[model samples]
Target: MRLENQIAIVTGSGGAGGIGEAIARRFVSEGAKVVVCDIDEEKAQAVAGALGPNATPWACDVSRSDQVEAMVAGVVPMFGRLDILVNNVGFTVPGFLRDLGDEAWHHVLNGCLSSTFYGIRAALKPMREQKSGSIINISSAAGIGGAPGLGAYGAAKAGVVSLTQTAAVENFKSGVRVNCVLPNAATKSLTAWFDATESGRKTRAAIEAYSRCGSPEEIAAAVLFLASDDSAYVNGTVLPVDGGLSSRVACIDATIE
Candidate 1:
């Protein structure tokens, strides 16, 4: 019950198996009322229905600032107040930089970076007013260390990290804590890319060599830590929930020069 009576909004939670859904479920289990938002109305409703009365479904295209602002504006009226926001809406289009077109690049950047910007911008007013809030942006190991074929994704996610730090610094004194989680979980998104490319195979092997592959639940646990009072002193930091993968270099050559 760490989040007892708190109200939270988790974006991009409508997919069949997404990290956002896991975070929403975890929040509910901790006694928080959650708004499960997604671009797909049906999927959002399904997740909310499964989470019972503690969760409500909202349809929103987070890449659009108007929709995001409206979503945040509606939260307090429905739930009484906003206490937590998990900006978890993002997807990757795996391809080398040369192979990716401008359309693809903008798509990834808008989805991963602009969406986060929209979420934080919209959530800040309410959070600042309350004088207490937590904003957890979902980042990726690729964002930190770079991935061979995930150029656009890595760049966009890296932007998320920078955005989180800036937001945290600007809002900490106002009582709104902003942080990020670089998750290295084996989700459908990662698995799809892994099954499709040689670079993906190598990346997965490297991750396995460093640590056990993580699950959505494990990532959800980390999100809980950031979202709850447990991480009260934490802000403007990038917490890698990647099973120690971020702690070491992924290079295979280990011989001493």
Candidate 2:
């Protein structure tokens, strides 16, 4: 058990099919007590129940700083100590930059970027006191570059990447390894986006061409590696688990004079 005797909190893990749920299962299987949190109370409880007593469900809107702080405080009382914090909550609003409305832009940013900030801020105090911990922020390939029609989401994820780097540097001497994971996983969110409209389908098809859709388990494995001693030397890195797609750059060069 890589995470034996560790206590982890994973955000946005209440749904039936999502990255959060996968992370919960993976952490539990590796002997970690996980707190599965989501905005939907019922869904959170259901997922926790299915995972057994070791997994507790909590409802929280991470975008709110007070709620986020309280969530961490509550977890410490129940779990004794927090060893890992996984900022897995995220959302996306698909549309061209000009076509995107203000509400949608804020919605995506709050859910994806702001929530990550709140979670990390709340966890930092405890981790710093303990002087040892790991924080994993889930980013996206769109964050590494620019993705048309996903401006809001892409921007938010990019913020997460930058946050990870900054936090890692600040917390380096404290033994708190802050890292980010850019996963290419097949989940409800991605599936719905891919099936939304004709244009969405085409975009998704192009994405699938370079690599087969990765499973949630695959992503869980990466998170586990970051959270464990395997990555003790790794810090402030944005790992792209995109199956080589992000590195696939085409070249057109001339060798003739």
Candidate 3:
């Protein structure tokens, strides 16, 4: 019960295949009263129901400022206090930068990047006043480096990492810690996306082989660490739970010929 009686909101926690859902369940297990918010109403309710009394569901689009505000305002009355905010709503498209359409570029940016800004802005009022809170943004390993088809996605995620660090420093005095996590989990969405593309299929297999492809549980563990007091002194870090992939390198010339 590390988070006993704590109040937490996990955005975009509808799908069984998303990081948001995984974080919600993990928070519940840690004794937090979890508020599951998503654009998918039914799916959100279903997950909330499964988590029992401590979980509540709300339909919200993190991209919308009004919806984000309503979600936080509603949660405070329902749960009495807000201690943690996990920004996990994100989407991606696989295509080269030159081939990507304007709509696709904006969609990727809105979902992966703008949403994080909205969530943090909405949560800051309460957290600042209370003088204690933890905000964890779900970034990706692709954000840490350049990728073939993730032009927009990589850009957005990288912004999330930068946002996390800046917010942490700005809010340090208020006791609000902002941290980002670069998780390399093999969720269903990723698998299906890879299955549809040749290069994706090959890259996915290679990634799985080298990293063993982490489970949602593993990512959730790192998240809980940041959420709990164990990481009180830790802030503004882009912690990669990616099986050493973040620090790895491939040598092109194996021999010193």
Ranking by lDDT: 1, 2, 3
Q: Each model's TM-score, in the order given?
A: 0.94, 0.94, 0.94
Off by over 4 Å in 1: 192-199, 252-257
Off by over 4 Å in 2: 192-196, 250-257
What residue pairs clash in candidate 1, if any at all?
A: none
Instruction: Write model 3 residue lDDT over 1-257, tens digit each, in one string.
Output: 88999999998888776778888999999999999888999999999999898889989988888889999998887777799999998888879998999999998999889999998988888999889999999999989999788899999999999999999988878989999999875487776767888976887787765675777778888999999999999999999998877776744425576
What's the distance in Å from true for residue 104, model 3?
Answer: 1.1
RMSD of each: 2.0, 2.5, 2.0
Report every candidate's CA lDDT: 0.90, 0.89, 0.88
lDDT of 1: 0.90
* Candidate 2 lDDT for residue 75: 92
| Tens digit of per-residue lDDT, candidate 1, span 41-118 | 999999999999999999999989999999999998887789999999988887888899999899999999999999
Pairwise lDDT winner, candidates 1 and 2: 1
